[model samples]
Target: MKKYLIVGCGFSGAVVAEQLTKNENCKILVIDERSHIGGNCYSERDPNTNVMVHKYGPHIFNTSNKKVWDYINQFCEMMPFVNRVKTVYDGQIFSMPINLHTINQFFNKNFNPKEAEEFIEKQADKSISEPKNFEEQALKFIGKDLYQAFFYGYTKKQWGCEPKDLPASILKRLPVRFNYEDNYYSNIYQGIPRNGYTEIFRKMLSHPNIEIKLQTKFNESFNIDNFEHIYYTGPIDAFFNYKYGRLGYRTVYFERGEEIGDFQGNAVINYAEENVPYTRVHEHKHFTPWENHEKTIYFKEFSKETGNNDEPYYPKRLEEDLYKLELYLKEVEELKRYTFLGRLATYRYLNMDQVIEEALKIINE
Candidate 1:
């Protein structure tokens, strides 16, 4: 029989624990500092409205990988969901991802798909053969007008840095559509768990050979010799006691309030103006369209540089941070009986499906 200690009971840890438990000789222990199972993906019913509220933020399960989708579906029922995000700029609402409808509406011109594509190509900066930064990428892709309206302000607020300062890779994640298709993601499968993400995690860890310890923090006090292997899903820098200083990260603060009926008639609305304090507002009730509620709960998301006391959300993997990360990786290689899992452990921004896929790969290896 073998014993494993899995730190941080998030999707990565839970998935690994579930896979390991398939072997009768394997026993697993999962621990999390937060008194919940799903990590940042944790969701629960709002006491007042009885609507499922995404505690940290809204996490819509979307992935093109059928294997990942089928693996997760085994634990919980997934309701079909389409994320149609909207952006507010200059007191006007527009469809996000710069679709053809958005272009026609924004410029007050009726242009078909081919016309729109040609227009954008002319607007793009043809002189720049290669985009070296985020600003250059935007200007090269859709020109200045579209970039300023949708990307500039929103990206500045979201990353707490100017677009020019960020990497070109950041803008590559976004798409420019020539049609009216406004679905936020191009994934083949997209949905939300019917019972909430917390339930999914609960079911994943229900095996007889698994033990869960909530509110338990992994620190120096825990003896490493006790377990055959350690699966750490926390911050890699923190695990080594900040021997090479902490890696940079951007954390979000949510300003929550309850309102009668729908707040914005949409799941998410982005405030694409730098003057506005918060980056976006999330209407939680709209997230779970299967259920209805009289009162709605929403959150005004504010992003800032993470501090020692704050929980790190998005990894700010700038050039300096990558240098620090490399140092941490060297230390990781020297260690024994330990494996890093998930976003924080690897210090990379990964979606839920990617995290699960990585977990499954590691366990199979």
Candidate 2:
């Protein structure tokens, strides 16, 4: 029998398994080094609260693709969700993305849309005519007060590099608003899977042609020989044995706590102040607002450096890392019958829906 192997059970791996299984001649076996599937978007029930908690972190499905949303609907119903994020700094909670309301609250002034626009113009750092780095870009756009409060410290702690060391592309992700809107994202579709993310992955790979092996790590020498083709979702640089040296990345350490009721009454709370140890806190119950849970679960997420030993999460795409990735590109070109996918594989951060959508496209291609 012709056999196929998937190195990881993430959405990327699952989508490939699903598409390959459609062929009656192929037998696909999926493997996840972790004891479970669903990659970082994995969700399960909390023993005490019975709420679906995102194991690695909160993974919201948000995208503009109707086809991707419809594809997800086949496995599970998605509850409508809006990512209303808040930023806590100087012991005050304000709306995120720095809208007109945020400006009013932060400055202690009642500035409507027109006034807010003028106020921001006055506050913007005029010294930075052409901003060179993350710090300069933020300062140029929002001025010292807003940049310091919302970005300066949080960004420094997150990347362990000064704002000058980082590129301006990071600050470009932040949206500036002249209106009172505070929604974190402008995406059309946003939601949490009604039955949890793991259930969706489970259903996606449940076909008889697919065999999932949990807690089974991939050993290329022995395992790769057994399968004719390989779809490796593990780290791309790691696959090349770190010949040009390991790529730099950031890993999040989550501290879970039991809450009697609600913690922040929001899904995500970003702590922009440098004094705070953790960057942001996620209230799991807030993710599923459709159902109310008496108890809540919250996570205090902290950033750490990703090395050869640590499980790579957020790829630190700076000068040095990109140079190393160029070397990885060479290694990938040298290979045959192997495709890398997902955050670990491509070395980039992505939301759950984006991961699924990208994987589907890869499979279709």
Candidate 3:
């Protein structure tokens, strides 16, 4: 039987390892620098509150892919979840994604669905035949005041770049509703895995042919050349030894505090004001809304430039990163025996469902 090396035990690696082991006669060696599985989405029972907390940050599983949903469901039961996000601007609370009710309430109008749609259109920049950038894109569709109120400051803080510098593609298809629906995602299939994500990792790697090495770093002595292929889920630039400059990534920091009662009314709350240092606050207990908790664990998320010590969270794929990425691609083509997988390897922001779906495609290929 042939053997393959899977580097990084993220969802991408886990799904691929499981599928390849079942579909082909391949022995798998899964490795991760982290002590546990599930990558950034790793969850465990919070010692403080006895609730399964999102370790690095909150990861809500929202995707419309049925196959991807079904595939994960086989490993662990999924509890229904709707990501109801809130936002605080100028010390006032509002539903995020700027839904119909938000519009009416913000403007102090009593518009219904039809009136709300017309109102948004009136607010939109009708003269803009084409949107030049992220700012223009939002203004063209949603109007200037709304953009200023909801997006402008928040985006500048989150990305550390003017929305005008960003590609209009970034704002494409941001969830906005004509109705009062504030569920962050409109996916037909949405939920949190019943057990923590670690349990899901356990099921994915349960096959006899798989060997997992946690806290193991891959060096020349690892003998990856002996294997038929290498599945790399680590950062693309790091994989090639930064042969091509470096791809930029935004690292995040979280400040936590225990709240005896509800910290915030929702699971995710966006701090849209630029004055606010942190981007969002996550109320962990609200994640498992099926069960209630007396105490809540919350995180105030702050983003920073990624360093060697800091774990890469969000890929800052600007024009400069794209230039570096081209060089990385050339280097990837020069490699001997490896296949890049997932958002990290590809340097794209991908959701959990997309990762699972992509892994299935890779296995079939």
Please, what is the TM-score per model? Answer: 0.98, 0.95, 0.96
Model 3 Cα shift for residue 194 (angstroms): 1.6
Model 1, range 1-365, lDDT digits (tens) per residue? 78999999889999999999985578899999998898999999989999998999989999989999999999999999999999999989999878999999998999999999999899999988889999998899888998998889988998988999998877665588999999999999999999899999989999989999999989999876869999999999999999998999999999988999988999999999999999999998898888879999999999999999999999988899999999999999988889998999999899999999999999999
Off by over 4 Å in 2: none
The CA lDDT at 187 in model 3 is 84
Relative to the unseen true structure, what is the C-alpha lDDT of residue 263 in candidate 2, on a scale of 0 to 100?
83
Candidate 3 per-residue lDDT, tens place, 27-102, comes to 9999998899989989998888877888999887878888888898999989988887888887788887789878
C-alpha-based local distance difference test score of model 3: 0.87
Candidate 2 versus the native: TM-score?
A: 0.95
Model 2's number of clashes is 0
User: Which consecutive 10 residues in model 1 have the weakest lDDT in total?
Assistant: 167-176
Top of the candidates by lDDT: 1
Per-residue lDDT, model 1, residue 349, is 93
**What are the clashing pairs of model 1?**
none
Q: How many collisions between residues are there in candidate 3?
A: 0
Please tell me which predicted candidate would have the highest TM-score against the true structure.
1
Score residue 241 of candidate 2 by CA lDDT: 78
